[model samples]
Target chain A: MIEVKDISKRYGDGTVALGGVSFSIDKKITSIIGKNGAGKTTLLRILSTQLAPSSGTALINSHDLIKNADEIRKIIVSVPQEAKPIQYISASDFVRMYLSARGFGISEAKAAAEKALRKVGLWEFRDKLTAELSGGMKRKVFVATALASDADVIFLDEPTTGLDPFSRIEIWHAIKALRGQVILTTHYMEEAQALSDDVIMMDRGKILSKGSVNELLKGFDGLVRVEGRKRRKMAYKVGDVYVSYVDRRKAAKFINEGEIIRPIMLDDLFIKRGVNLES
Target chain B: MNLRYVAGYAWFAGVHSVKENYPYLIAHLALPLSLIFIVGVLSHGALLPFALAGGTVMAIASDGAGTAQELTYLRLEYMYQDFIVATKTGPIDYMLGEIFAGLPWVTPSIILYFALDAVYGMLTLYNLVMTLIVSVLLVVSVSSLAFLLSSRMKHARLIGPYSLIFSYAMTVLPPTFYPFNYLPRWLVTTLAVFPTTPAAVLEQGFFGLEPTAWYMLGILALEALVYFAMARSFTRWREK
Candidate 1:
């Protein structure tokens, strides 16, 4: 479990990155959704003991983030937004070596590395140099490295950013298979809705909303996405989709031969919070 | 810290790292060998033990700095340090892992030095023992200094050329291949504080043909300890 109380970060020139943010996350997957420069990375970095917060405190498994950082380090693992291979090493070998550095014996490290690679569907290509691998494959290697560690707490910053859909799913599956608490930040609303048990929506370095999927969407209960020729009359445009918070019968009436009507999702909730989805 | 646990697989890990960068290892070894080749061809075995000692330490310092440089890149450019900062890998484990990974890169130089020493009849038991000690100290101290310097930089690639200069100057300008009496008193005092200064002094003396400062050996041991602590303290990871 993790508890963050009023954590704030200000840079050297007095730019506030995070301002009095607080949240408690349990032993479950939580998604932090934010646009670029919303301070998600800063908050995650501070909680993971990679940075010092200008004010406030955080605790992971009852250890103070700053005071017991070394102890915290022993129980956590982090995957950055972009993970580059440290050398041109084989993916599996790199994973094994990192595990070895984590105090695993040869046979145990091999077993763990193999299991992790397989989890990410990379076992067959384990011998490939990371430099030779595809971008998604390299990202999966980072995911495999995180999965192999078996730490109690894991932080992944935009784990699937820039990856294709299939590779994204593969990494999501690998992340799902891990048996520990996970905190992930992403710009993909679908990913947050699909994988997170709870989601925190952030904007301007502050959390705008925190709730489960159903809880967050409760306010948009009457809303439905209507797509077709007639959707323009009673709808608000969201990218190519048309959405409106109205009676289901009214929304369905606008659906034509080529149209589709579906219930509102996290995207509608985000739009309701005054954000333009395209941005 | 369970250093035994770290050692259990660190050697194999080091081997894997070395195996992955075979080109780097080859290139790293080739340069020093080429220099030794040039020395042998020029002096026809004239600069025997001095060349051996100086070249051996030069290889260790230059190549040892590489370990720190690579680690620094991993931390800065790749953010790999963030991946490992958590986990049970202690500082001792990290140091040993890096040092072990770097050792094989310097072994070729060590072998070449010994071959040159044998050809010139400079491989006395005393010189051999003394050279190994001084070489190890120089490797550890200079590598730490490199790590320290690398840690201070925000950008990657700044440490390489600078460390090269530091290693080159530490070996060439010191008393390793030259006589200590050639320097003024102020210069000697300034160079004496360096870990390699005493190393060169002792190596020259071990050959029984040049002046040496036996006390400088103790100073180098002290400097190595201090530099090790500095490296540990300086090379810390921060989100910045």
Candidate 2:
């Protein structure tokens, strides 16, 4: 459980990464979804104890982020977006070493490393150097560390980015199997929809919405998205295309043959509300 | 500081660095060995003692300063600093881990120079122990400065040149390769600002080349404490 209170972060050059925002998280998995520069990573970093909030503070598992950062650190693990394994170290060694640094004994670290590498489907490649592994496998090495950790919470910053579809699904399952709180930031709406118990949508430096998948998509019961150039009774201009959200019965009238028509996704939240994400 | 985390990280990082970058290990030896060669060939062994003592001090100080690049790379490019910040690892654990990680690169050079010191008939039990003490102090002081330098570095590209400037200015600009007695008293006092100056002076005293100035040993220890304290307080382990 986490409670963020009026947290704001402003850099030295006057860049406000996070505005005054307050929210509480009590989900098994919560995904922060936003476009680039939406303050998603900034917020994750602040909560993970890697960055200090400029104005306010947060309580992670009842420990204050600033006042009790050291205690908080013992209960959390974060995999940064740009994190890469040391090239020369084997995957098994990297994970084991990470566990060791987290205070696990040698045998304990080895067992945890084996279990984690197996979960991420890299147990067979455990002895191979990270540089010898594929890009996706290297990413899995980091995920394995998170899986091996006994921490109460795990923060992943875009863990599945740049991975192939199969690799992404594998990582999704690994994350799903993790117990306790897992907070992640991702740009993929499908990822947020599929894995997160709750989704927190952000725009600029503020929270736009927060709810379960079904709750967030409650209003679009029988609606489908018809994307094309034709104007409809209810449509919003998204870049060069017009996305019209209509009842399934009325969607046929607006769509021409071979035009794009798909089921409604969480992205429609922006289009239905006339919010252009690309802008 | 969590000593357990520090020791674990030091072993992990140190072993891996040596294995993966074995070829680059020679980078640490090339400069000192080259200086020894130049001094040996030109002076026909007359000034071999200066090269032996100065080369050893230079190697230790430059290696200490060069650790900034490793810290910067770990922080900015690999994001290892952020990854570990969420662990039980503290700032002091990370700093000591990085300093010890660089030891494997410098260890062979230290042994070689000490062996050379023995061959040149300057090695004694007391000199050996005192030189080792001075070497450790030099590393702590210069590496603390390196930690400070890396913490303020924003870009990885800038760290390479910046650390080079640091190594040269702190190790070479000081009269590390020559006798302190060669310079005037005013210049000696002025150049003592660099840790390498006192470190070299202390080493020269241990080798019996210069009269043992016990005060220089105090200066090196003081530098280590001041720089270590400054680095402990100033380094940006957590972003604002």
Candidate 3:
């Protein structure tokens, strides 16, 4: 539902935020994974039409971001990182105000807001002042607002950043239930593995790799687990054979009676592709 | 600009303004009431001009507070952007919202001053209505100017220093504290274009010579147009 074409953003002082980065996101969840300063936020901002790119363009369902910003805005909702709540307003009132501004009637806005809050497990706290809510709850409130807007595409930047483990899992499930395209950014590999149908790994403002989980795992050889009386070690290796640096006596003791032990997940393709198992 | 959306912005601004300034509301109302009493007692009818000027200043001050709060809470805090992104309302609607929100504070001070004038038998009903209308227009113009400045400059750090400099210059430059005859003809004409000049005119109309009401209304319309244009330009410029 989103197409990004050669989009690049550079600061005035010559700091390149994104350099010819391009990706397409459809109806499923796509996770953009990278370390700090990886241009993840910049890409999301451009997609959301919040910031203009230095060059190239992003399109949402064929609506060009630069030329059709108003239409793009109507269909795309973004939850920015560290988004502060509108203080002094109750959560329910805040939601109602946002929806009402978007042209929804009071009853419709209320029902949508309530449904979104319930999805994120925040329905009970709707009447409390948003400033009085905990950090996790605040994030959930933001999430609820985006969901209640009922936009066609949702961009979440580190949506589970401050949530506890349980809340993170719950949020993941809620995200999975969303009916439209989703582009999420995170530093957690586990989050990418669990929530994303496809992963785009970025480093230094460039796309290092973009593929499914199996395709990414193909870059590494099979994992080898060695359990000993005193200690255990795991080593990744290639082919049907697994190698480890151990004492000859220990190796012999484990390989008695001429019986050969084989690694279950060993594959020789990564070795042929010059992927170093040691690393 | 949709009326419902404008009403939403006005409602939001009113609730937030009251909440943020609730603790100081008592002090705010008391200060103007106290000033009326002090001038009535000490000057004994000689301080009419001063009283009118003081009331005009109070109206502008209260309106300034409201505009400042809206700028800090709505614009800088990103609440305004949320509305912009979600709604069909444009910059004009946002500007009008600020004007409507500022009316509460400015209206009360004007009403109180007129009530005081009536109690003391210092002003007629016809003159009182004219003064109130002028006060409303002048307040809207000044508050719009303040809001325009706030939208252009996002940081709150500069607002205080700017407000201080402008307030001092306006208080001295206009024929607010003294008669317009005390100033040069060219300077007097130049200052007449400013909102503070209309405020002074309104003050004088209440106390003595009544200036042309059309002139004051023209100045107000000009101020509104200029501020609205500035705000629209600022919004587009900031997007870059």
lDDT of each: 0.76, 0.85, 0.66
Q: What is candidate 1's lDDT per residue for B16-129, written digit by digit as tens?
A: 556766787666666456655666677786654466656676577667667667777877888776666666665556665666667776777677777777887777888788
- lDDT per residue for candidate 1 within A73-105, as digits (tens), equals 778888776768654678888788777656777
* Model 1 bad stretches (over 4 Å): A222-271, A275-279, B2-9, B37-45, B238-240
Q: Write the per-residue lDDT of candidate 3 for residues B92-151, one digit (tens) a residue.
A: 666666676565545556666667666667668676766666666665566666666676
Predicted model with the maximum DockQ: 2
TM-score of chain A of 3: 0.79
List, residue by residue over A133-207, the lDDT tens digit for candidate 2. 987888889888988996789999998899898888878998887766999999888999989999998878899
**Model 1 Cα shift for residue A231 (angstroms):** 15
TM accuracy, model 3: 0.77
Better candidate by DockQ, 2 or 3 = 2
Best by lDDT: 2
Which segments of candidate 3 are over 4 A away from where they belong?
A: A162-177, A221-279, B15-21, B24-45, B48-50, B53-57, B77-83, B104-107, B122-136, B154-156, B163-194, B206-214, B236-238
The docking category that best describes candidate 3 is incorrect
In terms of lDDT, the poorest run of 10 residues in model 2 chain B is B1-10
